[model samples]
Target: MVFSNKQLLQKALEENGTALTIVELSQKTQLQVAKIRQTLTTWEKDIVRIGPQTYDLKWRVYCGKTFRHTPQAIEIEKGILSTETDVYYYLIASFDYRAKITLYDEDDVAYPLTDRKQSKNLKLSYLSGLSKWFKKYNFEVNDDILFTCKDIKTHEFKIRRQKKQERDEFIIAAKNRRLADLVYDIINHTLPKQEGDMFLIRKYVYVYPFNDPVPPDGLIKVLANNKRFLISNIDKMYSWTGHRIKDFLTVGLRKYYLQNDKKDWIPVIIDTDEFGKYGYCSQCSERVIWESDIGWHHTKTDFESAESYIPNEFFTSDNSKTRMN
Candidate 1:
């Protein structure tokens, strides 16, 4: 009763809810040890390897689970204004309140100059710059500048503020003796918190105050939610949870898992001193292009709209959507 690689892996997943080590897989599948490893590499597309030896089938499975859905509200607005000799476009989207400014060359090619962290600051800067740029070029500026703002009337701010408050509560819990002791007790006694010597749950893994705070949930949830948790092309279904489980079982945990297994992972740092500076593109002398909001589309009207002002191709027939929008 020998099973194929796919069938063997499927059986292993059905028996194990969320984690499987390479040694455990080999025992269950009754396949040669070397052959099992080879099969895993070949089938990496469907399988997510969490650590050096742990693996899981990549698919969302809910036996009787229901996830509460709370959709985040998003707002968007766009406006077009006409000057005596030029047209100006403006757009604003909700979330963190950022603004993108683009300058057009003589060929109609748009080069994004800056992305302001605050929307109000962006509006003021652009307004001042537009007046100066237009006057210097002797071009008749359009007075009918389009202005739009969306989601201005919602309680989204309150919701986000509440969530932030809750997150702070959890952070406080980590420091409190009673709460920390209770969490540790649960991990040690009740939960299957250890795989080999490493902590099964990533939250239990300790870090110094200098390091970034541990994620609220265990590595399982982190891997499940983050798209960049696993190797992309090799295992499309690989997730953070799977990666965490794999690392715990095989690599002894404590190490940060990254999509590129060959490279060591670094924590994100927020430096207040270096914030709010304009970043320049090394490839182009013009300001670096920032696609913070409003994706560009290739339309005849959009192209012709700026043809008279810029000498470059403002629009192209190649319809590719960039993350800029």
Candidate 2:
């Protein structure tokens, strides 16, 4: 197997403790110095330049927790301070503590955050955070701030707020969304960690949209037609289908075409970084305006048009049949 550029650099950094020059790294890895420099620039989070020609691996002393590339925990706290679902607390450990989170505001600040699995109720994890920080951000019930775990050992996390247009914070509510979208969000969320990644349709009829529940028949219609949520024939269960293109925090750094309401294919330049996924429309400014593998929908207060995607989170690459998400 061939070593990737990042792998090569990581090996060199670990062996030498990051005291090598570009020329030395090139010789060790049998790569060009230009390539070495480029690799360092691209993977600076792993390997950083200390002095002019010196470098070091950016690692922290921690407990014996192996790191994994985890998806950021979205909708960390749905601004409403309530215990709505049992699944809400396990939301982080749902993926084996492999989650990162942060909240966006008109401005940003950082605080120490931690979660404790209660000895009394093993199922519930009591999250202790800076309650005053929420007040400082002035987060209304409509806003969502995702708090990502930076270090499990130290329980330290950072926060930042973007310009309103390029915000990671989505100021939206369920009632205002298209009826189809409401069902999608509810079912997508309520899908249990079961055999099929599915949810029972009738289970949520009265549970979803707490203020006003979706009609059981209409909810079935949304699930039946929407390709984003797939229906199991035998069990009559629903799961998030593999048709989302602009999955905000999960799918990253792939090119896509947004089919607007006019049916024009506008090329989208999507990219990913430490913060989160970004770049949907030249005009949308980091907003994931496209819907799952069907059509596009701007998720601001008022959503318009009917659309889906040809490919979504698990889409075929331009050059090959391999899936990228």
Candidate 3:
């Protein structure tokens, strides 16, 4: 029977129990090789490619309840649904309700405190006196597991520090894979790869917040210190060595900007070089885009409905608006 891509993927994952290879999937689904490759890349959230052509489904069920609340502290219980192993559970006791708490188990693995619409009472284990853990992250703590607010930037910096290595490796891998794929595409057409081609690729992958190719000085320093990208030895250019592409791709997907109240960084599509640094108001569909030198300007135009609030071509000197397949 013919199956949709999602259906086929779900079946293969269910049969394999969270582990499968590209070759095995192709054999089972009888889909074209290109389609399988596309599936693997597209199913990033559902499956993690642990090895070459091998994937692991990161499936987990979460349950959370607000157990108790008082002026001083709030308590919560979290449960996980896993058939293969024991269902995980934890009790979180927080002093400050405003400051979000991320619960970490004995193994130092963090479990996000998420909302569950329906929950049943479950006896869960508690890891006590973990205030020092939060303190290490610069979070103010009154007692065990008690949390208070700090500078948002400071908190983000600490969190970034904790995941720096993993993020860097992912960025590097993505950059390399993308470059390799582009080169293959070019070679298949028998076209010479120019130096400008590499910059174009970098620009595509790392969408700068500005009209110019140059990224903010602060952003470059962060990428360089984090070892995600390397400074050009010859020209005044920022080259993506793959260290922090995640930060770039996900720039406005979440909180928009790292600093300056979402005005510090502008977002855009790396491929089209089209500015994505604008947003529509939740109250209405009005658009906003960042003006060079000036801050964000709210326009009457809605970017989604129109050809872009701003044009792709930045200037007469810049021919980096070229698109790649």
TM-scores, all models, native as reference: 0.24, 0.27, 0.29
Instruction: Evaluate model 1: give its lDDT.
Output: 0.31
Clashes of each: 23, 18, 4
Q: Kindly list the per-residue Cα lDDT of model 3 for residues 278-324, writing each as its tens digit.
A: 34332223455434333234454554435334433222221122211
Model 1 Cα RMSD, 1 decimal: 25.9
Model 3, residue pairs in steric clash: 171-242, 172-242, 228-243, 268-276
Give me the runs in candidate 3 sitting further than 4 Å from their true place: 60-102, 105-228, 231-325
Model 2 scores what on Cα lDDT?
0.38
List ranges where model 2 is wrong by over 4 Å.
1-11, 14-110, 118-126, 146-156, 160-325
lDDT of 2 at 226: 38
Lowest-lDDT window of 10 residues in candidate 3? 81-90
By TM-score, how accurate is candidate 2?
A: 0.27
- Ranked by TM-score, top first: 3, 2, 1
Best prediction by TM-score: 3
Give one digit per residue, the lDDT tens place, for model 2 in 1-325: 8889989977986888536777778878898877877777622444645445655554432112111111112223422221122222222322224343332323445543454554553333344454666556654433333333345333333333222243322322222234344444443343131222112222232223322221112232333443333233311221224233231112111224444565433445445566444444544443445544444444453232112222345343222222222
